[model samples]
Target: MHTEPTAQATATTHPAPTDPACDALDGGPATELCAPRRGRPRSEAAEQAIFAAVEELMEAGRSLSDLSVERIAAAAGVGKATIYRRWPNKEALLVDVVARLEAPAPVRTSTDGSVRDELIAMVEYMRQRGLAKRSRWMLKSALSQMNSWPELREAYQEQVVRPRRAMARAIVRRGVEEGVLRSDLDIELLCEIVIGPILLRTVLWDEAPLEDPGLPEQMVDAVLNGVAAPPPDGRSR
Candidate 1:
């Protein structure tokens, strides 16, 4: 008669404990402490795959105009949504690819070097980049077509060219202030005088050699010391 109550009766008598922190606002059953994230986490492997796919396509003679998110995704073995999540469109993706190929410009600190040394470093960086681009057919082809693509061209100017020009200007300005360079010349003109030859060789003259490691130092020194020959009297020209 006094036997233990049925298991179902005992279970009904005692309820499971609940955590107040996990309870919903409406006082419903306890939920997870935090809401689940909305989307999948980014994967580095996937990103690298996408970049490789783009490069491979370009290397295979596929023009940027012919590339699409769908094609890239298939080549990369990822969903189109993955590429879209990272880049809004094909142009944006291509910009990143170009940037990866070119790499970042060198940065020099005041404590590490002088303005002349910085200028030499900048020119050397361009020389190396030119050599690298020449070695890669894909990069060469992509860069050759950049001018015709307005979006890509503008982005390149904003992201790469502008920053480099600004750096050159800063260095030139510092040189002028320190009396290392002539203050009579315009800053822009001075910048062109310093880096113009290297830029021309790198971007325009395909036959120009960039293999000479001493070329940067020679260029900087020549510009600083002037190319004009000395008069017989050893007086200023």
Candidate 2:
């Protein structure tokens, strides 16, 4: 319910997207979510209206599964036929809704600077994301459902983890290529090492609260100083 930009998930931002808010809950388009966009050249106005309604519903304190197509159509001032034409089912609609809300992959900064700085940025990004309102809840909910249904786990990995890994991989790769990072280290392994603690703190353990002062720096040290250990020369090669 605390929708204001808290500290979860990449700075915990969510101030009702500036400009006229678009649907933040899409899995891309209807096809991606398995909603056949068949029929006439669907009404653009209708689609926008539905997407907007989705945003409003969430902002107004309604969840994805809690909403119905009938309610959405009515809220958008459109017809049931128009709603059903694009989205075959509520799940597909919800998928699209989630996709819309999803943020893009994190941006990689110059690792050529220092391994310390690169990793600090990565941890900061994860820490901020962990502090987000909906994202934090979503992660906790996913783990709870992972026992009965594993796809929720996969969905979380696909949507959240994969993008983050890609970002971290790039940073690590850049460091290695520039000789700023040790060449022998496995980048993927490094990726897991870098992010595992953040996930543990944020998702699994939930021991370290984001409000804890100086925690971000501690996290950065735990990852960097461990993985990017200097070579036998007793200095970073």
Candidate 3:
């Protein structure tokens, strides 16, 4: 669902990359991420330590489940107060990480003039990203946590999902405006119907293909053909 936003260049503002301190946070040394506010600036050292500890621990499939605050503090080489000050708990930390994750690019449109081609490309994009091995697990985990943590879930939707949805809506509007797609179609429900197959495979049925180049085309033909308005024949079935 995460195609890049078209408005990112014009709608978003980027701060100047001048300050060495801020640059660290932007992907520089990173120590500047935790520069203390008033009192000698809290050590940026602990933030890096915590990140390394989290990454390494997660790589092994080990997590904060059995690990306590004291243990994570020790592993991160920061005081309990330090970790708590930034993140109330491990879930809070994970929420931030998930929000920062980058999604894959959308599927390409092989033939641009046809609405059918656009539909196929959209489905193809979803298939490509939805079939990811570990990302599926990560998605499921995040969805499960949402019910328990509303604010974190809302932030994830805002950062990750909303932009993707907006892109899809824009594409649908373009399709209709270009005269290739029917104007009567309901964009909102259409989005659900369009994406339902791949999502069902990825999240529910758990049967995404490892490689299926024609899969998107097939999905588009099936959904599009069935939903298109009645034929000109005027011979109602």
Report the lDDT tens digits of candidate 2 across residue range 63-152: 554678878877877777766666656654554555454433334433345666766666765666566533545434423544554543
| True lDDT of residue 117, candidate 3 | 67
Question: Between the candidate structures 1 and 3, which one is better when assessed by TM-score?
Answer: 1
lDDT of each: 0.72, 0.56, 0.55
Arrange candidates, best TM-score first.
Answer: 1, 3, 2
Q: Name model 2 segments beyond 4 Å from true.
A: 1-52, 55-70, 79-105, 109-115, 134-156, 212-214, 226-237
How far in Å is the alpha carbon of 115 misplaced in model 2? 4.8
For candidate 2, what is the lDDT? 0.56
Regions more than 4 Å wrong, model 3: 1-53, 60-96, 99-103, 107-118, 133-143, 208-210, 227-237
Predicted candidate 3 versus true structure: per-residue lDDT over 176-224, tens digit per residue: 7887557787987777777788777755765556367888888777776
Candidate 1 per-residue lDDT, tens place, 1-237, comes to: 111112222211111111111211222222221123244444666767889999999888899878888888888888888777666578767877886787356764442478789788878888988987888777788888987889888766654565556667777887899899999999999999998999899888988998999999999999989899999999987
